[model samples]
Target chain A: MSVFVTVGTTKFDNLINTVTKYSAIKAFQDLGYNRLVLQTGAGKIQKELDQLEELDKFTVEHYDFKPSITEDIESASLVISHAGAGSILETLGAKKPLLVVINEDLMGNHQLELAYQLYRDQHLYYCECSTFVETLKSSDFTKLKPFPDKKPKLFVDYLDNLLGFK
Target chain B: MDSELGVIAVLIAVVVCLVPIFSIYFSVNRTCKTKNPNVTSTKRTKPASVMIIAGSGGHTKEILSLVSSLGSHYSPRFYVIANTDKMSQQKIEALEAEKIKISNKMEYSIHTIPRSREVRQSWLTTVLSTAYATLYSFPLVFRLKPEVILCNGPGTCIPLCMAGLVLKIFGRDLKIVYAESICRVETLSLSGKILYYVADSLLVQWPSLHQKYPGSTYIGRLV
Candidate 1:
């Protein structure tokens, strides 16, 4: 059950339909993967999800409410998330390398800012929300870079600020 | 009765004279207290209740690292409290609530002010939104009652830290610290120097800030 936590929002179909046949979902199905859990609400898709219904061979589980997904996140080695900054940080803290698909409408160009910041810092991989399929398929999980050898020093200053270290 | 009234007047005079002397003495005492002491007094020091404030950005990411490093001693809290719409707040909150591990020591809360993304004809919109944000965030700060407030920027820090400064003045002892990021990519950004004047401690990830704010400490890179 190689579960991919797909946020089952309506926009997912747009990204999925772009896959044609070579999507990561299709690839996992071909590889005899058992189940893929969609961590999202069901009624959000308005006739748009039928195309995605073609891949029903991969047992689909819908966490109808967002809260039910307290544990579906634990299923994947890689997290696919909207380019929300909070999501990116959570995925990193979970110690899983992420494939970040950004929200287009926050802080003008903030999703890009976060992705580039993490990508530049070697924390995670960033890609456009428009190209979700391409991003996930090409996501090189095993080759993800680790955090720096030593902690960043401003951390020491933070400690000094909080504790006033002598 | 005449003698008693004169005694009363004399007593009032003595109290008035002593009050100024006491005020000057306390003033001098406070001045001396701020100076670096070779040996500390036996005063029972209260631990600083630190609040790390940041928005949904790299600023938040770096603050998380410090929260971990500062570890057990700093009993801390978090505040997002930003300028965004309700929908944006839901998304950020959902992501944050998902990320925050419920802990005995770590308490998390967020405040969002409703604002339109549209810029034109929205000058009034921004001012009202900013006012709303400031108005709601006071109780959060009051309840937490942090002794030291550390801010990571982008409009998120302003309201809470302003409250923190007020706490400093009225509460008679609180410090405001600003975490300066290594990169200065955004000009007129909330990060570059927003709280420079008020910050008791200004920590920078990059050494360049050392030259920029010679008074500021360059603490190297943050996470």
Candidate 2:
């Protein structure tokens, strides 16, 4: 199994640090995971990523950005991402098992609203930066419900109506 | 002679009453045609151009979803993004690439403007950057002459929307549509609040938002 961690085009050092640590890597390894791919935005977690390569417990690839992380998301067994709506929508759209980590240090509390909503809806699992490890240890991703196919046509109709399109 | 004068007065009264009715019809028709740029008689004509303010992260995603849902109704779309935002550029490039692969037409372009502020940047610096970004948008807005400008809740959208408004003030027929971000279940975001006044139409994803923002129209989630 493989895990993909993405911070979504912005720096979230805390989430990167938590996942790149030896303990987190080892925990995944013990659970039969062998590969990890991280798209680490602008954060300075490259030094730690390089050191992890030496351990040889699993293969890890890190990049500042990938034009299309969808390919990475598809190949991974699990996806760990920042609690951004785009990332969540992509993950859920793909019907992949997802674990979202919200950075509490950001300016507004908006991300919390989305994270909690999805969690309550059973669409995905969410953990704050502080409780990431504990939640990771306890959660069973198989039990999560698949995201429903949200009909996008309604939005189109609304726009057409608003625009007075025939 | 008396009967002739009475008949003439009745004709004048009828014309006066019909004048208001005709004016009302013309006004409604004019607003509908101009306010809705996509109301062309046929779809075979070139699709209307839309200028979208694609902010980083979530904002970019929501806009992408909106474009996809629009399908071929609007075309030659332009995305305005922050100058330093390589991630958004990459995401858009990826989306465009996939779209081209699916269909051979290329109808979108991306423009980068200076960011108003970086994360954790000082307020003094933010003001300077914002002014620069707003000034930079003036030429781009004139160049594109987009029929419609679409934005969600993001600080980056403010200057671009203002530029569109400036164009409107100059007697251009353009519409600015602001969709409050889906994440705002209870209240509007900072950008949403500012845009509420300038945006020609404000749409909220959650119905509850209509009570707070009386003019806001409730639409289901775009994503």
Candidate 3:
């Protein structure tokens, strides 16, 4: 199986760089992930990825972006993503083991709040770029609780009652 | 004596303008307080007209998911998106197509308004653009006359909600519901902060937000 790493629509060079390191590749291999698929948005890491691919330790694939990463996310055994709510929810919706890497440079601490809340709920593991490797090595992906299912019915019923449809 | 009379004339004009403005404000507030949303009115045979505001990116995703959950009675959906956002239209169309497959009936229209602000835009320009958008929303809101407006956190929603308020002032029972984006855990977004005072029903996904803003209801994770 492969490990999918996505930075969503924004440029996140730190995440792309950290995961491309030999240690990260070895860690993926340790987890039995023989292929690494990287969705590197606007990060010029293809050259480094190619160089690592030549080592023949495991397969390395890289792309800039796609209209939808759902297919890739579904196929992968594990997903490493930026702390954007959209990507986090999509990965969680796909019911995959997700390791969210926060882009601390971005303004606002809401991303941290979302990641922390989910982490507290045992739904996902989150880390900064500095602790990427350690978190990967130490965290138990199997123990992660599946994110609660989307209950649109609650909202519909609420609206219907509020609007006097019920 | 002539200058004093001119000053008096100007004061009268100012008071005349201020009277209507203050009256409208109090009238809107009274309507907001007195309208009991919990009281179920007599059921109608016809579908209710709804206006859905789709913001960019995650806002659009969350709003659409909520829309998909709605029953057929809340139909003839009117969608408003920013002209600059190219992605939300396609997503809306896709969702509508999916709805048609299930029900074989589709009633929705999409409209675009000028974006109030772009990323990194100057505050001065943002003010002017927002005012322009607010003016643009009045006609759209008047034309649609939607009974209900559903919006999540987006800069675009503020102007539309204002328009809905205007309709309310004109004796129309337009209901505006604003759902704070789920990304906001502790604090509300800029749009959410503004809509807190205006929307008929303000919803927050996180309990902390609900506790912080007594006006907002704590609805569990919507998207």
Name model 3 segments beyond 4 Å from true. B1-39
Q: What is the lDDT of residue B205 in candidate 2?
A: 75
TM-score of 1: 0.57
lDDT comparing candidate 2 with the true structure: 0.75
Which is superior by TM-score, 2 or 3? Answer: 3
Candidate 1 residue-wise lDDT, A72-147, digit = tens: 6566655666555445545665676677655444435423554666677677776655666566666667677764
Task: For residues B1-223, write the lDDT of model 2, one tens digit per residue.
Answer: 3323322332343234335533564465333233433444534344568898888777777877777667665778898898877777877887777777766899899998877556545554555666666667666876798878998846677767776775676556677998887787777876777778889888887666778899888756667
TM-score of chain B, per candidate?
Answer: 0.61, 0.76, 0.81
Q: What share of the true interface contacts does each candidate keep?
A: 0.22, 0.41, 0.65
Residue A146 lDDT in candidate 3: 97
lDDT of 2 by residue, A1-166 (tens): 8999999878998888888777788878877889888899988888877776565767888888876789988998899999877688788889999999978785466656776777887988988777887788889999999987777887677656555564
Per residue, candidate 3 scores C-alpha lDDT tens digits across A1-166 of 9999999888998998899888887888888888889999987776776776464668888999898999999999999999989899999999999999988796465656788789989999988888999999999999999999988888988888778777
Displacement of residue B152 (Cα, Å) in model 3 is 1.0
The model with the greatest DockQ is 3
* Strongest candidate by lDDT: 3
Error (Å) of candidate 3 at residue A136 is 0.7
